[model samples]
Target: GGWPDAVTGSKKNALRRAIQYVETIIQTDISSVDNIRKDPVKVRDLMLSLARNTATVATVKTIRDDMVRGDADNALSAPTIYGYLNALERMFVVEDLPAWSPSLRSKTTIRTSPKRHFVDPSIATAVMRLTPGRLLKDFLFFGFLFESLCIRDLRIYADGNDGQVFHYRDANGLEADAVVVLNDGRWGAVEVKLGTKEIEEAAIHLRKLKERINTEKMMEPSFLLILTAGTYAYRREDGVLVVPLACLKD
Candidate 1:
């Protein structure tokens, strides 16, 4: 099985085994030893909610609603939810893609809400109880999950280069899935698409984003890339490199 098709029950079960270990460690070590007063059920609910929303921008308010909607008892306050999210970050279980506040050509206000992602996509599938068959039938949702997977890999590689991963979205509604910025300030923008048919549109969006960046305030991007799930990888005429996720090394 390939990427999407590999998301089967057995695969999820294997991933769940790791989730069990992390939960046990948190319950026994971090939460207990630190005497954190948060509710365990609320923490579980928050993790599940974040898993269900793998790659999308999520605010504390939205996540709290997700929790309460799933279980009315989970009406946790925003501060409580933030505490839980912070704990997960400390445990290396989750991360937020901070918004990029770059100087731009237009007066587009950057949306500050960070996109939520688990360290690994399989954790999301395990928590959400998603299988390959279900994901195949629901490409719209699976695309988000796939982007989470890509971001996970990007983070790993970016760290090796002393770079950090950030997301871009403005008030005008334009966006980039991930932006890699190195310590020296050189950067690249990326858009992730799970389908080949969306390649051209994604490329156009990257070009437009590049145009908006104020070059006087920042170095020009080292490259613009569109990551996809398609089989072929090549550079478009516009100089944007399209790479299949399967071929990504970092």
Candidate 2:
């Protein structure tokens, strides 16, 4: 069912509508989920944690450390956070991007921490109360949220192909934003770039990651994609695909 109508009616102001919609969601939905005491405050803070660290590798220690650095008094213990995380997982509120591990040409220590993300990126924006104007003022954070959104879409698309989306980063900081590996073991790499200017660097990184993979032990990547916010989608001469985000729906 399309969600039952919210009380945001007749609100011509988009920001007001958005805020009321999220509030309505929390009061109406979070209260109904099973397996947890109904503490909206804890759930709210849990969401705040995901918002602050979205698209980054956030382990329990990572979240606890980040929180402690911000406000020691407000920091949730690791056990508390784990309990909330489990509840959110059951409710599909958070779906982390697991790390991709492949045999490498070098002995680079792969960072196995899962990248933190919400089922929908807008949850971060909503809980953070960030409008598009506010997001525009902090473009770097905007990019992080953009990556979260891209990852969300990639997960949806990968679902049809029996593929799982993973992220990759090694000790040396080499990384890919999304790695779609199918059940049969074929895989593809993707980098989410919000601008055309970054496509060149993203493409270079994708190629570097492919090189790091020990292809002899695994199938060569079926594709290398640079997903961006550009207006057009095309193939680069170097065999990398530069696809606009809009093309995904098409």
Candidate 3:
């Protein structure tokens, strides 16, 4: 069969360029590739690295070398890394969660920084070149990225459900990573953690939110969700929901 005329023109050129980019990184020798698939710790490190360097994304080759050196010195070309991340995202391997705010009072106000996340932890590990052994020391960084990932998944799940994803931060420095509003105007708050322990801190933020916005006028029956890395999901004694990150997906 002959190649279609449309496929022989601009489309073909674009495909060739994309394939070249993929080949450039995939063809490199990086032993960490296998480790990334086998170790969850490695995965967590990679995602945290990316989160720490939110100013830019790196290419596979750069990320590979950086993993070895423990720095971003050999970071990938910005555009190349972005393309690779985008491909991973399309495959549900990674996700770049964007920050959002509601137009409750004025439509002109919007959040400035958007957070990024990966869908599958393994993909993040591969990109960052981390191994399983490194996770223990890097738990805090992983926690933040994990929360970002959970928020991304929850936002996707809440789509078309009359709920909007928002991050709350006041002038005094109180903040909540995520907020979901139901169709009836009821809302839920979420805080992401790496482990199942220490959810009271999350609850404190929820309480602060309630205090900032008068409950009788603007708030509904609120819930504080603490997304953990554990396997189980349950409500805490304080009425907060401690959910596993896996249960948040659509």
The residue-by-residue lDDT of candidate 2 on 124-219, one tens digit each, is 787888877788999889889888888988898999889899999999989999999999989999999987889899999999999999988999
> Which lDDT value does model 3 have at 243?
82
lDDT tens digits by residue: candidate 3, 110-177:
44454555443433444544454665569765665566556656766777686767666544556677
Clashes of each: 0, 0, 3
Would you list the rank order by lDDT, best first?
2, 1, 3
Measured over all alpha carbons after superposition, the RMSD of each candidate to the real structure, in angstroms, is 3.6, 3.4, 12.3
TM-score list, all predictions: 0.88, 0.87, 0.55
Please give the CA lDDT of all the candidate structures: 0.82, 0.82, 0.56
Which residue segments of model 2 deviate by more than 4 Å? 1-32, 68-74
| Candidate 3: residue 250 lDDT (0-100) | 25
Worst 10 residues of 3 by lDDT: 29-38
Candidate 3 accuracy as TM-score? 0.55
